[model samples]
Target: MDKTTIICRCEEISYEEVEEVIEHGGRTFDDVKRLTRCGMGPCQAKICTGLVANIIHEHTALPLSEIPLQRMRMPLSPIKLEILATNSTAFSAVKSVLDEVEIEDGKVR
Candidate 1:
C-alpha cells in the first residue's frame, strides 16, 4: 500500500503515520490514536477503528481480540444541538422536528 494513502480521513492521518506509530511500539488502536489522532473526529472511530486495527495486527502480529478498542467519550454518536438545547420530556422532541416540515410535489415546504 502507498504510504501516502490516507487511513483515517477524519483526522487526515496517513498510512505511513500509523505505520510509524506501530513501528515505535503502538500496539493498540488507542495507542495509534493518541500518537496520531487517527480516530478523534465526527465519526468517533466508527469508520477508522477497524482499519487501524488491521494495521496494528500486521505490525505486531497480534490477534484482533488482543487489540483493544479506542476509548470513547460522551455523545457516542452525533447529536443535534436542538436535542440537547431544549427540554422535551413532555413531548416527542425528535418527532416534533420532523413534523414541522411538510413535503409536497417532491419538495419540502
Candidate 2:
C-alpha cells in the first residue's frame, strides 16, 4: 500500500517537511510553526494545530497534554506583524490567562 501525505495547501508543504522539522528539535508548538510553517497560514493553526500536535506526539513519544500548546495571543488569530508590533500595548495583555485560571485536582478550574 502506498501512503500519501499533504501539508498546507497554500504553502504546498509535505508531511515529510513537517516530520523533518519535528525530527530536528522542533518540539514546541512555536518551534514547529517556525520550522515548517504548518500553522502560519490563513487558517492560523486552527486547522493544523491538532494535526501537528498529533504528529509531534507520534514522532517524539510525548503525550498529547505534555506537548506545549501553541501560545495564542489576544486575537486567537493571525494578524499583520506590523500591526501587532505597532500596537505594543495591545500585546501587553497576557498571551494567555494563567493566573485567574485554576487547575484543580488535575482538572481545569
Candidate 3:
C-alpha cells in the first residue's frame, strides 16, 4: 500500500486506513467516516463521498442507498462553540434564514 493514498486530502487520511475501517465492520458511510475520517475533510465529502461509499459497499453486504450520505446542508464541519459565538453576524444570518423556514412533521416545506 502506498504511504500516501489520499483518502481525505483535506484531513490527510490514507486509503489503507479507510479500507481497514471497512474491513472491521464499518457498514455505513458515517461509520466509515467516523472511524477512518475519509469523508470529513475540507471538501466536506464532495471530493471523497462517492469513493468512500464505494469502498464501504465493496466490503459490506448493504446496498449503496442504504447508507445515507452525511449532512451537507450548512456549517459543514464541527466548529467550536466559541468560534460560533464569535461569528455573531454570520450566525445571525444563518439563524434568520433557518428560522423563516417551517417544518411540518419533519418534512421541510
The candidate maximizing TM-score is: 1
Which pairs of residues collide in model 2?
Answer: none
Tens digit per residue, CA lDDT, model 3, 18-106: 88877787776677778767666667787887877776776675688887776565566667778877848666666444775899999
Instruction: Give a tens-digit lDDT track for model 1, residues 1-109.
Output: 8899899998899999999999998898888888988888888889899999998888889999999877765557878878855665755544444676799998997
lDDT of each: 0.84, 0.72, 0.73
Which segments of candidate 3 are over 4 A away from where they belong?
1-4, 76-109
- The CA lDDT at 36 in model 1 is 88
Inter-residue clash pairs, candidate 3: none
Q: What C-alpha lDDT does candidate 1 achieve relative to the native structure?
A: 0.84
Decoy 1 TM-score against native: 0.71
Distance from true location, Cα of 15 in model 3, Å: 1.9
lDDT of 2 by residue, 1-109 (tens): 1123765555556777878888788887788778767677777677777777777888899999888888765557766767877857756564545555688999887
Please report the TM-score between candidate 2 and the true structure. 0.62
Instruction: Output the TM-score of candidate 3.
Output: 0.60
Model 3: lDDT of residue 80: 72
